[model samples]
Target: MTGSDAAGRLDDDDFPAYTMGRAAELIGTTPAFLRALGEARLIEPLRSVGGHRRYSRYQLRIAARARDLVDEGMAIEAACKIVILQDQLAEAQRINEEMRGTASQESDLPPG
Candidate 1:
């Protein structure tokens, strides 16, 4: 896939794209900061067969949000917490959708 500039929608082809240093350069952050986020579980790094940190476009977006929160004067820990909560909320929403879909499917079925 062709490269996408900032604000462009990333595709699966964007996966396994950025190495740690390159990702740091693209996000305007240090590799240490990215590692810290990984330690905090804010962003899960994709590990290669040799265990190197490979970042995806989606992970870069998370890093961008963490950077934004830090620049807004929030502490890194607080920023990490916000990111975690947002992830949990997204998971909850996904589960709710699945449950609702199951209910709908059941309603559409004939009585047993």
Candidate 2:
């Protein structure tokens, strides 16, 4: 990729820019914790060409939430499930809002 492209990717939350170690350190967690999250199907870090795991900012946010739940006495598996459900709920809510907006706009139009 070009230098400009690489620079822009740094701002992309979904870009796997952080290495495993850096990701763990940034979140104040351990590499093993990240591995456990991976095993639990929580966050799937991308694999680099050399086989190292790379995490995105978005994944780190999810990891941080999972870690918070764990700190609150939730099991890792349960935390993962909760995070998944939470994500689904957020998406559903967003879609519902969009549909509501569209329906309101349609209602404003005169019937054919």
Candidate 3:
């Protein structure tokens, strides 16, 4: 791949650029914690050719949020559930906002 192609991947949140160890370090958590997250079906990391797990920035963000909840004494399963619900709610809100914008634009046009 070209230099620009690789550079663009740096801006891609879904790119699995971090190894398990690095991901754990970046999120200030342990590998076991990450493994537990995987067990909870929170986030699944992509496996490398050699069978090592690799994580993306997006996964790290979710993991970090789960870690926060866990730190607050929440159960792992419950924390994962809450995070999933939060993500769904955010997506729904975004869609609603977009629909509202389209409706408002349509209203500005002449009635036909």
Candidate 4:
């Protein structure tokens, strides 16, 4: 990849730019914690060609939330479930709002 290609990836939140150790350090957690999150199916890191785990900014954010809940005495599995539910709820709400907006626009049109 060229310099421009690498530079642009820095701004891509989904780019798997961080190794497992770096990801753990950035989040102020241990590799074991991140592994647990992966085991729980909360955040699946991409694997490099050599089979090493590579984390994206988006996965790190999810890991951070899981860490927060775990620090508050919640079990890893429970935290994962909550995070999954929260994300699902947010997406559902966004879709509902979009549908509502479309329905209102349709209502505002004259009957055929």
Candidate 5:
């Protein structure tokens, strides 16, 4: 790939750039922890050509949040569920804001 192409990928939060080990190290966790998160269906890592798990920055953030919940004495299963619900709620709120903005804009238009 061209240098520009490689540089562009640096800005991609979803790009599977970090290996499993690196991801775990960056998040101060273990490989098994990431595997457990996957098992719990919390975050699904992409597979490299050699069939190894590759995580993105976004996935790492989610994993970090799960790790925090687990550290707070929450069960792994419950932590995963809470993270999933949190994601869903955040998405719903974003959509709601967008819809409200659109409706407000429509209301400001002249009656036709």
Candidate 6:
């Protein structure tokens, strides 16, 4: 679904707030599993004012994707590596786009 579709389902305030128990429930996984995912750096939960793990909706979605990958017969280690690579690729793409934008701006500038 698109961002608009998700936005229509819940308010913005709903996105940034979830206890570990609630996050596990929302992702259809166990609390222990969610903790393990955090340990493995699969999903990062926000730290509350009291140092509690406050999982956002995005973290729940990451857990769901990890579950899907594991369910598809991928080894957990491999799935984790794939997720890391995907994040790195996205970052690289963003950097490339920014560089292109800068180059385009320079090209549009008049000669000194």
Best by TM-score: 4
Clash pairs of candidate 1?
none
Candidate 5 local lDDT, 1-112, one digit each (tens): 9999999999999999999999999999999999999999999999998999999999999999999999999999999999999999999999999999999999999999
> Which lDDT tens digits does candidate 3 get at residues 8-101?
9999999999999999999999999999999999999999999999999999999999999999999999999999999999999999999999
Measured with C-alpha atoms, the lDDT of residue 80 in candidate 1 is 90
Over 1-112, each residue of candidate 2 has an lDDT whose tens digit, in order, gives 9999989999999999999999999999999999999999999999999999999999999999999999999999999999999999999999999999999999999999
Q: Could you give candidate 1's per-residue lDDT for residues 1-112 as a string of tens digits?
A: 4456532534574576789999999999999999989888888888888899999988998898898898899988899999878988999999999999999999999998
Range of the 10 consecutive residues with the lowest summed lDDT in candidate 1 = 1-10
Alpha-carbon runs more than 4 Å astray in model 4: none
Q: Report, for all candidates in order, the number of backbone clashes.
A: 0, 0, 0, 0, 0, 0
Which portions of model 1 show Cα errors greater than 4 Å? 1-14, 46-52, 108-112
Clash pairs detected, candidate 3: none
Global lDDT of model 4: 0.97
> What is the C-alpha lDDT profile of model 6 across 13-108, one tens digit per residue?
435589888888887878887777878888778778898888877777777888788879987767777887888999999999999999999999
Runs with alpha carbons beyond 4 Å of true place in candidate 6? 1-16, 46-52
lDDT for 98 (candidate 6): 100
Better of 3 and 6 by TM-score: 3
* Candidate 1 vs 2: which has more TM-score: 2
| Candidate 4: residue 27 lDDT (0-100) | 96
**Comparing candidate 1 with candidate 4, which one achieves the higher TM-score?**
4
Estimate candidate 6's alpha-carbon lDDT, on a 0 to 1 scale. 0.80
* Per-model CA lDDT versus the true structure: 0.87, 0.97, 0.97, 0.97, 0.98, 0.80
**In angstroms, how far off is 13's CA in candidate 1?**
6.2
Residue pair clashes in candidate 2: none
Residue 77 miss distance in model 5 (angstroms): 1.1
Error of 4 at 30 (Å): 0.4
- Candidate 3 weakest lDDT stretch, 10 residues: 29-38
